[model samples]
Target: MEHIPHGSPDDPNPLRRLSLEQLRRRTSIKWRAYPEDVLPLWVAEMDVPLAGPVARAVTDAVALGDTGYPAGTGYAEALASFASERWGWDTLAVERTRLVSDVMTGVVEVLKLITSPGDAVVVNCPVYQPFYLFVEHMGRRIVEAPLDERARIDPGGLEDAFRRAVRGGHRAVYLLCSPHNPTGTVHTTGELAAVAALAARHGVRVVADEIHAPVVSRSARFVPYLSVAGAESGFSLMSASKAWNLAGLKAALVTAGPAAAGDLARMPPEVGHGPSHLGVIAHTAAYRDGGDWLDALLGGLDENRSLLAALLAEHLPGVRHLPGEGTYLAWLDFRALGLGDDPAAVLLERGRVALHPGPPCGTGGAGHARLNLATSPGILTEAVRRMAAAL
Candidate 1:
């Protein structure tokens, strides 16, 4: 695929083109979930406009009336190229990759392929809420390895969970949230290496959800779980949905490491039938030609990250906001406010600001809420003020 450069690093912000009114006009879940008077920050959708390349690709496909079932390896090849350029993961085998309807579907399907019903899946708690729900729905037991004091992937805690997950002759699976969700702590190469070793020793298969890897901050570099040593037994779920704001398109890639190729080969043929054809085109364009736009979006999000901290400090000093190294999500600890566990409900009803409740995210989430930071500074400031006033 040919890639066209959209802008340079010196380019002005491309994400700020849309105004708040323009954003509210969106019919997506993020905008439609709450009343116009309420500020909706509960969902993961970003309030940014589409990258020029992605919009053009989707438009061209529509113009051509080329909306057949998805075909070809364009999405996988584009992702492999992006991984090589961005993360120094040059050994990725595009042929070993598969397509899925989305990240969560890929995770659930891969879990099904590797483990039987009633097997255990280990996840870091206070993690992505869907991890617990999907695993349980798949008839698998949930084993949690809670994050350490600093909200990092705890190596010791992981090994302990792995031991428990594999007990009683159960097939064990580890659902790794790389550059993790909510907390935004990007795992180091050493941490991933330790996880790989532990999973190997405990006979656990590692499936990494790397959808947020592309939006990392300048202060941190994202390391692909499959790129680390001893990670050959793992699988990765990746998509352009989160970073490119293409969630409505519905497409994702499920890549298998060299050692796990045979396991993925067992995936049902119909499993690849759900991805949208336009989604493939848009995702391909984002990976191939949207580099400059991504860089600009990163610049905007980095500013918002700092802006959120300043707003929180001024309006709600008691709230502990840890600026994460990646993702546009902020995990706020509201314990200091003496709010009961899951303060999001209080904020939503009283402050008229919707945030994702924490307790549903499992351990380490009491008295916390996950705030979406991918919005205008004015909106963020207003949300903080409303939250403060709710007190």
Candidate 2:
């Protein structure tokens, strides 16, 4: 395969041109989690170089010693602009946006403002693992609404869960993962609208985690949950962390819909204190000036997605995978190979390729693993080959 041209959006390739040797030298969790012999595909981190604009913004801030407490709404304004241009969400209110340390942190703060301890929080199963972890850590109980046979959200299942969540007149929260993690099922606008209607009728508040919205494939459109009708009561958590590979910066935004503004205002002022000043600068640059680089990345990811399907078919035919319309993570079913419920453990111990275990994602995760697809074609193919060899 041809190498992606680094830093050029017009090149039509999105994979970072960096080689494995270069990536392995980094101290990120993705590379350092396992021994040198293991191929790490477990974490969400992408093997990509920073966008030119983002790097420049951070470097400029460092050079001037501008690092300090974050101030102003520049980050929010950039997000508003990006939303309007990218998703046609022109009514997104920049003034109503609040900054937080990260997407998950923002989610926890939002949940705390709306519900009390022991309140039920609903989630679709096989979701981003942190959703389950954080909700429980916040002194709330988790309610699973597992996806349907097609691995997409089932309206009936969601409504049932919502009803159960609100039983005994308890306030409930629904944590939605748009462009859902693990499965990579990008929820359609119609689906989101229906969800909004259901949540309204059931008196449930929806908190959408839309951090992966920017990285969706061209085949699908990312519908902002708050943009749907009847969603004025919802909250949205967004960031440049996932799309721009800036997780270490620790900055994210929490935005409230028209009806939920008061709820957001109720959040403690200290909730905003943890965001890094440099994170605001870098994320602002990403939303305002990193379009070309992001476009290039999308192109590269498009190719990688296809390449992964082909490689899996050839090397590990027994592992069933659905070609996702968004995100770089691929959900693979290893049940056909009888790898047991925790295929990831087998892959790590025998195949020497680390992957996220399926069981931890709750129901619908048995005998499965989530593979990160944001790496070079060679590495992905090799990982598949190793899995095949292990079996």
Candidate 3:
């Protein structure tokens, strides 16, 4: 197969290049969840065509009838290469990595290995909604360490939660969302190092969800949790799905730090059976050959971030948008609009625009809405206009 040229950063913004009609044709939940009249800027899914390498890799496999159970460590090796070249982290040992169904599934399985049922799991509040749902569903208790007023990790608050979580000699795990969702705050190295120290002191195991690691803009750096000085016992879950827009292809890696390799080794053999063979192929292709495409996408997301801030300031003056350094998600505070806890509900009902409500994101999320900014600029403009109209 001929290699696809990785587009330059100066290329036209991919997000602005797609049409609404083209996006509506997608069968994914992002488009199908809402009626035609309603604009959906809710889900994490991006509105762009598949990267050439990923599309070809999957399509070529289907053409050859290569569908079967996943095998080999190609995915792990590819990720190791990507990590080394991208972040200068040359310590990613492929032997410490295990393939699983997706990031959340990997998180659950890793937590199971480290903590039993009824154990406590700590999380930063106003985080990704699934962190709450998945942890609770796994029969674990959730303790909240709410982010400080600036939406950055509060060392004191985290220490308090860690201290509380391990008070009874109970096992606890701190579920971290790096390059955090909704808020889009890219955790600094100093911030992550502090978290490692706190977790170490409290005997709390850290499991970082780094699915959005590759989506960071040029302005911010994504610090892998396990790379911190005191985090040799931590675990990290990563995948190419989010960056490549391949969520339907369910495959992810659970990487263990040097101290946690034994725990990862103890994960049930059958757990590896969950990932689709095709998903593995697609993800492997993404990590190995999708770098150029990823750079191009990041450029588009950066533009959208600026566009969103300008639009909100001009159209919905009451809305406060703190643009994130990573991910295409925009966490907008609508409390000034006097819309109560869930302004998203009102936006959907009155404005025919859909957004993920802030309350569901946990404490500090009230009166805020999470908007997906991975769409065409036109859609974003219209969504804001409708939101203003509703207000």
Candidate 4:
């Protein structure tokens, strides 16, 4: 078998160093879901090599056949150390964190502990599509607190949603996507503090999906929801999967704020059983030793975002892209092209380019598309070229 290199952690532009041929050979949904002719810039997966530390950790575990049920507090400890060193969040205690299979699962579990079946889950629209799916799957009604024109949390919109959500005296949980997906809007500290105050006043529980916490650009700071002054009652789900490209590893930590610890304590013990042993090993290694690689990846993503902006301007002038401050996903508005509500369908059909359709992203997503910017510069150029050709 020939060994294929996935580029080094030191690469200035890690995304550019990847081999498109090798990426095409991948069996992940990002590659397999589409036919050979279609270029996939839809899924959240990045087209880069695994970080050295992460690779070694997973490889060693498999070589030693250490695959078994997950145990110990190492994952939590690693995250705590990372949070302190990276974001000055020293209050993330290991004792207050629990292991879960993945982020969405952790979210559902937390919601179960705090709210009933008919309870409402509030979300900022043009969000990660799964929020609607998972919340509804758990028998919770979803209330949209759509982001404002700039993709930032709308204070008035949120207040209105909260009022409507709890109108029947029903328990409500705000499923916040920090450093929001698609748009890549990293919420400010003041914004989060205001949200905490609002949730407190409305008698709503806050569950932050901070999976993209570590993926922020240098221009923005990621404030942990619990780090805010009035956020002591909020819950957060943190994971290294998104930042480190370890989505297949399946491990996440559900953390409770100081005041919410008692509520988290009621969760069933078996909920922790779902995380695979290897998953814990990979995620712990990522939090503990993957910093350098992550920094490099972020640098690459920064360049890619800029490249996408330039490409869109030169080729797809009618398209509007509000460059995100975090995550490698780019939310593009194609209404100027007059493609109706689903421009992605036209792009896929005519240009053989697959971008995540906007309609599924809920209200405010019409005539929009989410493009994955975690790929090589050449691929991004080609995708825009194809899109322009389609137009």
Better of 1 and 2 by lDDT: 2
How well does candidate 2 match the true structure in TM-score terms? 0.97
Residue 245's lDDT within candidate 2 is: 94
Q: Hey, what RMSD does candidate 3 come out at?
A: 4.4
- Indicate the TM-score of model 4: 0.97
Model 2 off-target regions past 4 Å? Answer: 1-16
After superposition, which runs of candidate 3 have C-alpha atoms over 4 Å from their true positions? 1-12
Supply every candidate's count of residue pairs whose N, Cα or C atoms clash at under 3 angstroms: 0, 1, 0, 0
Worst 10-residue lDDT window, candidate 1: 1-10
lDDT of 3 by residue, 124-155 (tens): 98999999999999999999999988889999
Q: For residues 1-391, could you state the per-residue lDDT of candidate 4 as single tens digits?
A: 1233445435566685676787888999999999988889999999988888999999999999999898899999999999999999999989999999999999989999999999999999988999989999989999999999899999999999999999988999999999899899999999999999999999999999999999999888999999999999999999999999999999999999999999999999999999989999999999999999899889888988888989988998899889999988999999988999999999999999999999889999999999999988778878888889888
Q: lDDT scores for all predictions?
A: 0.90, 0.91, 0.90, 0.92
- What is residue 48's positional error in candidate 3, in angstroms? 0.4
Candidate 1 lDDT (Cα, 0 to 1): 0.90
Q: All predictions: root-mean-square deviation over Cα? A: 4.9, 2.4, 4.4, 2.7
TM-score-superior candidate, 1 or 2: 2
> Model 4 shows how many backbone clashes?
0
Question: How many Å off is the CA of 285 in candidate 1?
Answer: 0.5
- The C-alpha TM-scores of every prediction are 0.96, 0.97, 0.96, 0.97
lDDT of model 2, residue 80: 96
